[model samples]
Target: MFEKKVNIYNVFELRCKTTCYFGVGAIDKMRDISEYLSKRGMKKVIVVTDPVAYKVTGAWDVVTKYFNQFGIEYVLYDKVTPNPTVEQIDEATKLGKEFGAQVVFGIGGGSPIDTAKSVAVLLEYEGKTGAELYEGKFTPEKAKPIIAINTTHGTGTEVDRFAVASILEKEYKPAIAYDCIYPLFSIDDPQLMVTLPYKQTLYTTIDALNHITEASTTLARNPYSILLAKETVRLIATYLPQALSNPNDLNARYWLLYASAIAGISFDNGLLHFTHALEHPLSAVKPDLAHGLGLAMLLPAVVKEIYPFVAEILAEVYEPIVPGLEGKPGEAEKIAKGIEDWLFNMGITEKLESVGFNEGHVEKLTELAMTTPSLGLLLSVAPIKAEKEVIARIYRNSLKRM
Candidate 1:
C-alpha cells in the first residue's frame, strides 16, 4: 500500500483544445455556430451522422433551421455506422470534396464524430486515402474545421483529438490523434441524449468509465488526469443508474454527459493503456461489437494486471463502485473480482464466449493487439508489461463469466 499524504510538487502540461457548450439548451448554440463558420467564410458544410440518432434526437431539425437562417449550404452523409470503416471515411471525404464542403459537422456519438474527424483530415489533403492515413504513411499538419454536435452521454470525441476507424479488410481498427482534428466548436446538450435507448445508454457510459480508469493509471498520467478521472468516476457512479432506471432523467443525463466530456479531456491529457489497447482488437475482429462492451469485458482482467503497479490510485478512484478495495499487492485479484461483480450488477453480464468468441479466437486477437499500428504504443505505456503471453491471458480470462 502506497497511500501517502499527497502534495502537489510537480508541474505538467494540460491541453483543452475545443470550445464546448454544455447543458440543456446547449444545442441552441447552433446560431453562434453558424456565425462562427460564416465569420470564417466557411459556408458549405458536410454533416457526418448515423442514420437514426441525429434525426430522432431532433438535432438535425434544430441544426438545419440555423443553417437555413444563416444561408449556409450543407450536404448530409447520414450513412455512418458503428465501428466506422476506412471505406466510410473515404466515402464521406469524397462527398465533401464533391460538394465543396468547407466545414465538417459530426452529429452523433463516437462513430459519426470519429468519421467526421477522419473526413476533416482527408479533406485537407487532396489525394490522401483513409488507408494511407491510418497506415501512418502521412502526418497531417492541418485539417478543415470540424464541429461536433454530440448527442450521446459517452464518447468524449467532441472534446478530444483522437479518432478511430477500422480497415475491415484487414480487421484493423487504428486510431488517429492529431491536434488538427480537434473540433472547432462542440455542443453537449443532454436534451439530445434523453432518447438514447437502454443498451446504448449503458454501453456509452461504460465507455466513458473505461476511458478515465485507464487514463488515470497509464504511464502518462499526472495530477490533472487523476483529478479529472476521480470526478468522472464519481459522476458516473452517482448518475448512471438513475439514467438507466428512468431513461428521461435529464439531471442524470446532464451529469453523465459532463462526466463524459471531462473523461475525454482526461484521456486527452493522460492517454490510455490496457483496456483500450486490447478492446480495439476485439472490435476489429468482430466489427459488430460495441467498443464499450468490448472494453467492459476486458476491464477486470486489465485491472488485475495493473493494480499492483498503481494500487493506491486505483483503490482511491474505484472505491466508489468497489468499496473496501485496499492498496495492497496481492489484492489485484480481489479488485478484479469486485469490478467484475460491479459490471455484472450494472447489467453487463455478457462474456466473450457469449459474444461468439472462443479459445480459438484468442490467438488472432493477441496477434492484432501486438501488431496493430498504434496499439504497441498503448502497450508500452501500460502499468504492466503486456507481453504476448499477458495479452493472450487477458483475453482468455475474459471469455468466461466471473
Candidate 2:
C-alpha cells in the first residue's frame, strides 16, 4: 500500500442540467401536470420504454392518458433493447421526428431512459444517424429536451447526460458520449420499481454500488466524489435487500432509490471509474448477461485493482457490507474475498464462462474494453492503464471468476 499522504486531482465536471424531482408519491401528484410541459413550450413528446414497464407500473398508460387528456400528442417507441443499439436510437428518434416530438419522455429502466437521451441528441442534430453520430467526428447538433422517468433502482444512467449504446461496426463495443448531455427533466418514481423482478432488484443494486466504487476508487482522485461513492454503497448495503425481500418496504425502497439518484449524481460528476470500464467489454461480448450482472461480476475484481492510495478509505467504507471485513489482516484482500464469498451465497454467477463465455473469447473482449470511453477509469485506479494485455487479463479474470 503506497501510504503517505495521498493527493487526488479533483477535475470537477457537472453534466446534468435536467432537474430531477424525486419522491415515492410524485407520480400521483404529477397528474394533470400538462401545464408544466406547456410552460417548457413542449407540444409533443416521445416515450422510450419496453413492454415490461407497461405491466409493472402502468407508467406508460398513465403518461399516455395524461398527455392525451391534455391534448398533448405523443408517440411511443417500445422497441428499445436491453442493451440498446444504434438502430434503436434511430428508430425512436425517427418516431420522435415523425410525431414532431418536442420533448422525449423516456420511461422504464436505464435502457429506455438512455435511449431517450440518445434520441434527443440525435433528433436535435438531425445531420447524423446513430451510426453517423459515432463516426470519427461526433458532435450533437440539435436535441429536443428529454424527460426521464426511472423505473429501476440502478445504474443512474438516466441521471446523467451520458448515453451508452453499441455501434454498428463493433456490435457490442460501447460508444459513450457526453455531447448533448442535457435533460430537461428527470423523474424517479419508486411505485414503478415495486414490480421489478427480484433478480433485477439485486442486479440493479450491484450496479448502483459499482457506480460508487468506481467513482471513489478509480484512477482519478476527486475528494468530493469519494464520499458520494462511499455513500452509494453504504445505502445499498443497508437498504437493497430490505427492498428485495419485502418488496413493498417503502422506506427501504425509498432509501435505495435515493442511493440510485445520488449515485447517478456521483457518476455524473465525471469520475465513472474502472468497474464500468471493465464491464463494458464483458457485456458487449455477452449481451445475455444484464448490464448489472456484468457489473456485479467485475466489481470485486475491480476492487482488487483499487489503488492503495485509497485502499483504506475504500475498505473502511465497505466493511459494513462484508462481514468481519474491517481492520482485518490484509483488509483489501479480505474485502475482495468477502465480496466473492458474499456473491456466492447470493447465487450470483460472476464468471463470464458460467454466463456463457469461452476461454477463447478473452482477447476480443479486452481489445474492445481498451477503447471504451471510460477506459480512462482504469488509468486512474491501481495506477495501471489496463493496456491491451491488462485489459485482456481482466476479461479473462471475469470470464472464469477466481
**Steric clashes per prediction:** 0, 5
Tens digits of per-residue lDDT for model 1, 1-402: 121232212111123688888777788889998987887788999999999989999999999999998889999999999999999999999999999999999999999999999999999998999989987999999999999999888889999999999998899988889999999889888889989989899999999999999899988999999999888888888889999999988878888988999999999999998889889988998999998899999999988888889999999988888788778878899989998998898899998998999999999999999988988888898888889999999999999975
The residue-by-residue lDDT of candidate 2 on 78-184, one tens digit each, is: 88778777888888888888888888878888888888888888777766787666442576755777777788888786667666776645644454556465566
State the C-alpha lDDT per candidate: 0.89, 0.69
Q: Which ten residues in a row have the lowest lDDT in candidate 2?
A: 3-12
Query: Best lDDT goes to which candidate?
Result: 1
User: What does the lDDT come to for candidate 1?
Assistant: 0.89
Question: Which ranges in model 2 have alpha carbons more than 4 Å from their true place?
Answer: 1-16, 323-330, 372-383
**TM-score of model 2 vs. true structure:** 0.88
Query: When superposed on Cα atoms, how far off is each prediction in RMSD?
Result: 5.3, 6.5
